[model samples]
Target chain A: MLHAPASPQADLQSEPNDFSAILAEQTDRLLAQHVTPACLKAADGGVFPAAAWEAVSDAWLPLALVPEAAGGVGLDAPAAAQILRRSGYHALPAPLAETMLGLALWSAAGGAAVEGPVSLATGLLRLASGTILAEGTMAHVPWAGAAGHVLAIAEAPDGARHLALLPRAAYTIVPRRNLANEPRETLHIGTAPLGPDALLPLPAPLAGPDGLMLFGAFARAQQMAGAMERCLDLAVAYANERKQFGKPIGRFQAVQQMLAVAAGESAAAGAAAQVAAAAWNTDQFPLAVAIAKARCGEAAGKVAEICHQVHGAMGFTQEHVLHFITRRLWAWRDECGNDAHWQERIGRMVCAQGGAALWPRLVALRAAANGDRGTQP
Target chain B: MPDMRFATVAFPKDAEDLRLQVRRFLEAEKADGRFVPHRSSWNTFDPDFSRRAAKAGYVGLTLPEAYGGHARSSLARFVATEEMLAAGAPCGAHWIADRQSAPQILRHGTQVARDHIIPRICAGECYFGIGMSEPDSGSDLAAVRSKAVRGAGGWVLNGQKIWTTNAHRVHYLLALVRTGDAGADRHGGLTQFIIDMAAPGISVRPIHDLSGNHEFNEVFFTDHFVADDFVVGEVGDGWSMVTQELAFERSGPDRFMSDYRLLTELVDRIGPAPDARQAVETGRLVAHMGALMAMSGSVAALLDRDIVPNVEAALVKDVGTAFERDIPEVARRLVAVEASLDAQDDRFAEALADVALRAPSFTLRGGTREILRGVIARGLGLR
Candidate 1:
């Protein structure tokens, strides 16, 4: 049945457009040059890599999803997703993904584009009247300390939701870090409120309670996919280089088997991420994002484990560059709706739809994702 | 890394339309009591049902119209096949032939072979069984000692083939036979022949599975004569020919949906309002299934583009077969039903029992999980 010679065809279905591919290649090159081991180690010690952040900022990638009319690149979500995947591939030391998402959300909410990185706050947040006094603290907010502004949705006492852009001055950051030592600060809103322009109308996508969480999970899934690929790459390299007994460890069937499983996980994660990316802004977004997060999050742990095992004791130490990616995989898997979390959400959704509707719903999601190709909502 | 990527596939309007047509046909069949959705699956042999499906233009989808096929796109075929499997249609009789054998013949068989066999296959009157595994060669296919010597106008085959699914009943067996010496690679000098089951000098003995099913057989070929017109591809190229089709064999929805009925039954048993555990496990399975479907469809798309996604197919089968094996295990946990084939009144229990008995074959067939991982590892440059 498969008699055709192995060759790539010109009518490729999933190849990104020329513009998106060029942008992704450029982002990959930039990350390869700037996100050095020294930068990752320094950032892991709670010191932000200023140079890397500046390079990212100078490229105006944070505004990638913002409208071109809004003085931004106006790339689609999948294009931005490619950049996010690159960030995870390099174990990027800055909050480029968060900022890019925040800028998109802010611009969609009719807010003007802002300079510097922007962190996203998603939790129980409330804004009071008058001076715009806020209640509730957002914990584990990515780069809250380093970001120039925090984009959040807060409910007023009357129950009206407001999309607020809180500058660094309006919030106090109780600095914290994730497993990878990336800034995951807790933000305490100051009693002094933001300016009148801080509040913008909530966009349709963000109107639902799960909107922000879904986007976060979607972004993290893409990042996890990239991180898992890095883990597989690292593990494959180690297996091919590290000698065991009489030959390279890769020559051993046992070692080869484990890395093969890791390779499978990485490929699955990448496919899941692509599905989620394709489903962005579509009706399939919520379920697709949930599946992506759960699948990618699940793969991240396995990939990290195999990579570490392949490296033996060398990968356990702070000296090795392998942990830079694996540690981030560990952290990102739990950041936005971990495996269990999204699994339960997916469970509820699937259960609500019952068993008979499952296949039709899944097929519909595929059709929607396929039909919505390359077109922004 | 052998390009271990599954690019997303966009089903054309024709494919999408075919999905509804297939679904409607299955629903009508179900409504007419043609088959029990809970009891029959793709493995359940029903020649009448296969004939009806063939009449509906689904049996030989993607094959050339000259041979009585629909000549539809691969995506269209994919949609039809998935719909059939999803509805638990008893497509066993034509499944192998429609999926691999007929396509294989179309691509590599002699003109006489194609003219003689493909139309019968497309008509669903002819069935084919795989003749790869032997007594000593299961996973190590290169160890196949089945040989066919040059005799008269063709080859005279004298060898035994074990674990041949439907060999006792199928019209033909695409057997790999040794025609010459084994080269350094052990993959050379072999050839494929279309063994006519009804021809002389061949006998089949049934091998009952754990579930007491006679789906497998051990066939003995005592000087079975195969005409030259039945030769598939070039002599001594059988190894590559067989290996090339692994992607197709391993990457379809059949790998994952073998026990899909159990999942649907589990959901129905638990009702719409499942407890937290049931919901979570079922949900996880659904997520895995969704991902597998995406990956499988992407592979179908790649094949449609004439790109062989061998590694990607391996990954899909590895993950998918695991998912298939998990269905019965998770079902038993979610609902407190003793799995038993005797539970005729309990659809969930019966389905679970049937699937649990067959679960071992899920990963074992097409390619074992270990072998698939090895293939993937080779793609990763690990070997």
Candidate 2:
């Protein structure tokens, strides 16, 4: 199965000013105004929620993959990741990750625009016969329970990349518990996957040595960032409310120090993730992605432990959401190419080249991703 | 701190071709075996050779032309340092002075100090050392007990300084002294002086590190006399001055390029197209260095713009040291080369063994990792 290279990005343009900040801010507004209020009302309309997706889709959140010409907001990678992370933070039990992942595949296929109640899954998918063959069941699929359109990626037997798009009704929603109590489910699609035309003949499924690791890392790092944020909020709330020695626990030095470290973990992780996502948005993929993954992976546990300690006995209790946050941190820490894995990868890349060879390597990666392999710098 | 700022980073858009020019110069130096490739390129002393280097307009490349300096951008100076370091040039005599002292003098020192010292430094003659940390203070810089009280003649100093690298050999010391008693807050009232090392009240004694290298020294000043004009910056501002110098100290190729020689050797020994594991190991390290270099280069550009990105600089130094220390470990793991403290092989092995033994100090020397994290934590609005 020879995968065709993705097209040279022709629609690479500057997004509107404050697009990311606006979208991030909208996560709260939409989550509170639309997502939460909407989801709590429609839990009986099947396990997968089309109502929520349709609402978000109408709001231009679903067409994140669409270019400016296609009547979409034309959000880039970083902006999308930011929205997804906030989605995680708000625990808006919706299939946003799925929609974005599918739209990503659709965008790669030169589709008109991405839309509908969508969801995304990360693992391996393959195309087989007339059916879009799917393999590699995705673990920790966010919003899997509420997705209307699920995009599952698999490598075909012929080596061509395939994207399987199943409607909300098609998936067997085997409910699963995620670290955070966000909606998750096991997606089992038959060999007769989705429609062939729906299985867009996309280029390589971004499963290369570094790209896959990076994308995976970015997603996990985003989730970890959300957990870190939640932890900080949890700790701050606990510190303010829990009193000891006739004062709030936050007044104590030891509590403050631990809280400080957790805050640091969040900042470093967020900084690294943002930088990486920003790089990806600008098409500087591998190096930025690797750095983000490494830093975020290291920060995940650090924030979790500090935060858990800050919560003390309450955190360990299921009644509180602290365990939920730490659990996500634990899961997401190893979700991408773990810290050790990416560190070794980065280390080896650095050692192999001359101190000054980074320029050529970057130029080469861009060219390759742009399907201009023979273009020498 | 969270402003939308842009750092141009240190890429001379059209000046990459100039690398060839520098490489040619280094090659010429290497041809006749004029370059020895010492273990400590910048720290290794070679006064005559350094004078030759300055004569080539390589030293003081960033200072103002009015002061006999080359008036080049920091990138150009960076180019010169990168080349010198890559070639293992013994730039000890003028390295610190060129990198730190001249800049301080040009920016903050008295006109007399700049006139007397700048041209000579540009010509690779006079040198200076940081006299910040005391014997008890260490990285707890605010704890500096080296006090200088105002006297009629100028000032009288009685204090002991430690870890003053190349201080014994340098012409002057930029010692931070308490000009007045500071209560509660340990950093108050400290002043920086361009202390002439040859003054009668000063005694410099070399203290070899655990590596048996006469790298640093302890200097005791008993009633050391200095003119009021000798102060580097305003009175009671030594802490800020030292903090600013740190942005200079921490953000440089020096942070990561310390053991780069060993890294290169490891790769050279690895040969072309390494096995899967080796490729993975070496590839990742090299990639990280690339990103680290880019980040550090960004900070350099930030410094060039006169916007002291202290937090960004701290990030660079912290991440840079972690990568540096990991280099030797990765290299050793890749190829189980015979490495030990007692080795006396080619200078390659000697340097590797030396760097391996000394790598622990990489994090410790430039503020410990713990402190760096604390700094970063604070910078991130976490503390």
Best by lDDT, which number?
Answer: 1
- Reference-based lDDT, residue A191, model 1: 76
Give the Cα-based TM-score of candidate 2 against the true structure: 0.79
TM-scores of chain B alone in all candidate structures, in the order given = 0.98, 0.93
lDDT score for candidate 2 against the true structure: 0.65
DockQ of 2: 0.17
How do the residues B171-286 of candidate 2 rate in per-residue lDDT, one tens digit apiece? Answer: 99888888876657766788889999988999989988887888789999998899877878898888888888888888787777777667666666666556767766775565
C-alpha lDDT of residue A228 in model 2: 74
For residues A1-377, write the lDDT of model 2, one tens digit per residue. Answer: 11111321222213223444555676667665654533533432334445555566666665554544545555555566676677656544555555555565566555545445555665565556556454435555556655556665556677766555666655566777555445556767655556545665544536455433455576666666666776777777777788889987776656765665565456556655555555553445566667666666677788788877877888887566566457767766776577767766665665566434543454333222223211110
lDDT of 2 at A140: 55
DockQ of every model listed?
0.59, 0.17
TM-score of chain A of 1: 0.93
